[model samples]
Target: MNDLLQTYTFLNQAMQSDSLLCLAQAVCWLDPLWRGYDEDFYHDPDGILSAALVVTRQLFPDLYVDAIDKLRQGATYATVDQLICEGISNTGIPLDNLEYLPYGIPLPAYGVELNDADFYTTHPEVIPILACFGISPEANPYHMTIPDCVYTAAEIIATDLAKRPEEQYQQVAWGLLWLTSATNNSICDWDAELMMEVEPLAWETNDLAFARVMIEEADEIMGDVLTGLYWLTSEPAVMQAMQDNIHRIYKAIQKKGKNNDAPNIRLKWVDLAICPE
Candidate 1:
């Protein structure tokens, strides 16, 4: 098989695996609390700041584990920032001379900027690695927005999809669909909606009949629950149906191979499923 097909198969296998499913569940469970930091930070700076320091650790576990451990031991943000500075220094990227931006600036763009010649020339692996966590180096890279994290992740994935051949559109759609499903249960519905919004025109050319089938299945199985809660409730049967639908589409893509006749299914129900009414 070609590289794109190989990638499709790998992603499908990973999504179908039990471990990623559990990881999705864990992310969903913690999403509400993660979102709360947005509002809480303004009202309770210390508390929210501390919570953010801890959660931000998830983005760079290798570099931030020691920082996280210190935070758990009641280390303040200053202490954590010191640890991060040391970690960056250890990576040979000197941060002491860089000018810092205020916290909460837009992330994906900033992430892109970080990958530019200035930073990437010195830290070649930095952009791709930070892209994974939705982070870009800012002067004050100590803070991040929850929404930006979601957006950056989808943006990076979509950009990757775009760089591939047009025949891979179905795989891109399925990939975004899987990401949407995985992250939908989280506080940010915008990631899925953004994926839908940035959807390439190639996706619009998908087989309408197959698209309708997927939509109807999703509607029947999910109904208003998808919109009403902005997340899937603990409905086992419905969730299973959703998973089966995803796998069915995956199989279809695999069967079609590079035929270009593979269903690039898009659905009106997708908006209704994800957006708040």
Candidate 2:
């Protein structure tokens, strides 16, 4: 169990570096048993490393696929590590000098306490850091009060939106929409009713409408990859209302800029919205 936890810690740091070489190293570490492991291992009940890997793959599909191919060809972890080091050296990101921070460094920034064992259990990828902080596995973040962390995160984002620059509003809006949709996806199994509670908070500002229009315009400019924000919601009424508002606002913006090109927000934000924690 300790070995697995250590590997999870290493992979988590590697992915956060946003380095293709580091990501490839992490993928190689998992290649030995990922496909043959039991369902529970894949689900990663102790941490969210599996989900993080999925997000890493989505972000660097080509690089990840190449790493998978090498794994299939029976590449050892040492070999893969060496290859990653070589790649990092070529890119001037000094592999030898890279110091891995204690996993606890960013926890405070997220306003999360390491003692929240229940939260760590649900979000296993956080376990290593919490362990580093000497937080017991039995401790609870909210003293077992069962606080609504997701809703709280959304509220925080909404509160801060007005303080940001105009150029960042779209990104903030995208983050809000993603938070709502991803939270819904996570709860759709048992607590599906929670989404109804989240709807009003999501639409509190013009963000939902902005996200819808951005997605619609993205589909027109890029492709269908960004067209499914409406479907992310399980409630039909909520989905329809959001879609209607999106169309209304989108049309108004188009008419108001009849001779001008539509504003182009990056399509990558849609991909970011669905990224795993």
The TM-score leader among the candidates is: 1
Per-residue lDDT of 1-277 in model 2, one digit per residue for the tens? 6999999998887777868877667755655334433335333453333332332254334444554566558775445445543443343222331121111111000123333444456656433322322334555455643323333333343344324444333343343433334212222111224423343212112543443444344333222112222223323443343334344444544565654443332111222233321
TM-score against truth, every candidate: 0.21, 0.18
Per-prediction tally of clashes: 1, 4
Looking at candidate 1, the ten consecutive residues that score lowest on lDDT are 101-110
Model 1, 1-277: lDDT tens per residue?
9999999999878776878786776665444234444434233344534444433344335654565456447775566566665664443332331112112211111112232345445544433333433445564443433333343333434444445444233233333433334323221223333433442222122432343444444433233322322333233333343344444455555676776444453221122234322
Question: Cα lDDT of all candidates, in order?
Answer: 0.40, 0.37
User: Once superposed on the true structure, which residue ranges of model 1 sit more than 4 Å away at CA?
Assistant: 1-59, 97-277
